[model samples]
Every structure is written in C-alpha cells, then in structure tokens.
Target: MADETESGERGNVKTGGCLCGSVRYEVRGELRPVVNCHCSQCRKTHGHFIGYTSADRNDLVLAEESGLRWYQSSEKARRGFCHQCGASLFWEPTEGSSVAISAGTLDAPTGLKTVRHIFVAEKGDYYEIDDGLPQFPGTMRGHPLPEA
Candidate 1:
C-alpha cells in the first residue's frame, strides 16, 4: 500500500461535489487522466458525453453524503448521483476499490487533461468527436487507458 504522496505529486488531494453542494467528497490519490465516455448509458445518464478521472477507493473520503445515491448500472458497475440536484457523480467497478469521479463535478484548477474518447461508436448522432485525441470505438479492453 503506497501512499499517494509517494508519486512525487503534491498532496494529491482534490475536493469536489455535486451541483447542489450536498454530496461533497475528497479524493486523496493519483487520478487517472480524464476520459470522455460516450457509451449509451453514460450519454443518457448525463444527457451527453461524460468525462471522468479515476482514483483508488481507499484514497477517497466522503465529507458529506446526505444526497448521494448509488445505482447499480450493471453487474460489474454502479453509478452515483446526487438525489437533491440530480447531478451525476461517480462510476465504480463493483469488484474493485477504484472509482471514477465525474470530471465536471470537480472544482476548477483540476490539473487534469482529456486523455481519450471511449465508446465512440455509441456516441450521440447530434455531435462529432473532433477534439483530436484518440477515439476508441469501444471500451479499453484491447486498447489501454492512457496515463497522465
């Protein structure tokens, strides 16, 4: 179990919350680069593409959770949101300690960058992904999720 600070990163602590401010949280580890997910579930749940950055579960601390709710989206995954404001929040693998934090929920100065666009085949018909980053037609099973 290596401490997050051992990565030569700063405190590696970032605070974020839902739109209504009722579901604040703190992430205290290294965050993977932001990935724009265009899977149908994500598009529908967020009413558009969803951006996320992941961190180990052990490093996350919930400071306030009064409005948080978790929806088991699939056998292997769950989605989290704010009940008070309907703000999409988290995505976590059911069997792992890692969780994906909604990139939009983090306060500015995130010090993060978009690493890639995933599930592009299921993207909405209304828009195009022309941001110049690598676009994968599906998940990162064959392809790898890039590190920041």
Candidate 2:
C-alpha cells in the first residue's frame, strides 16, 4: 500500500469546480498523498472528515475567475470557496510549502492514497475511523511520532 510520506513530482492534471460547476482549477504537479483530517473544523466544513492532498502553489492554476472567495480561517491559513454556491475548494497557507486541494475536486481519477488521519481524538462522536491508518490526536505540528 502507498504511504503518506511518499514523494514524487506531479505532472499536469485537470481539476475543478463545486456541485454547481461554477469553479475550475488545474494542477501541474504530483498530488501529494491524501490526508484524512478528523478535526472538528474539517468535519464541520466538509460535513464529515476531509480528504485532501497538497500540491506546490506554483503548480496550482485556477482556470476560471468567478465565484471564488477566500476566508482567513486562522492567522496563517485561509480557506477558499465558491462565493455563489459555497463549495469548499482549497486550503492554502499564508506561508507554507504547498496548498491543499479537496481531492473530490479532481476531474480525472488519480492514484493518490491516503496515509494518515489527523485530529483523531477530536473526531465526531457519531463516526468511527476503522481504517487502521496512523492517527494523530492533534495538528501535524503539535506532536511528533516516531519515524516510520
């Protein structure tokens, strides 16, 4: 099985839009392994856990200029969405290595695999994560786990 730490260069891929098909995006690099975030914020935003993958900011290209709004979710992070239809599209760092895109937005099928589950402790009470993937109790930077 593929793991989260796996790294490689991404090539151009077609990706886009919300439920209403009002937004579109294109990425030109390898899609980072998927990350399953069980954090409250993620669950609340996505109506469940959020499955996402990161890509270099340089590789992210938005094809359309309409229906996008950026919300500053934290001091260093912001969430992008469709202003008209309210679709969560991207998660970007004010300053970081890459921007995370909703994996569901990709237009073509990808080989990306999910490696870890974040905020396991704070996951919703109604659901149980039985995937046996690595689970962290908090944010990625809050604690360190032994190297795999």
**Per-residue lDDT over 1-148 for candidate 1, one digit per residue giving the tens place of the 0 to 100 score:** 3343432233557878998889988888788899999999999899999999999999888989999999999999999999999999999998977999998887666889998998999999999988899998989767776657
Residues 67-93, model 2: lDDT tens digits: 888889889889999988888989998
Best TM-score goes to which candidate? 1
C-alpha lDDT score of every prediction, in listed order: 0.87, 0.78
lDDT of predicted model 2: 0.78
Clashing pairs in 2: 10-29, 10-30
The TM-scores, one per candidate, come to 0.89, 0.83
lDDT of 1: 0.87
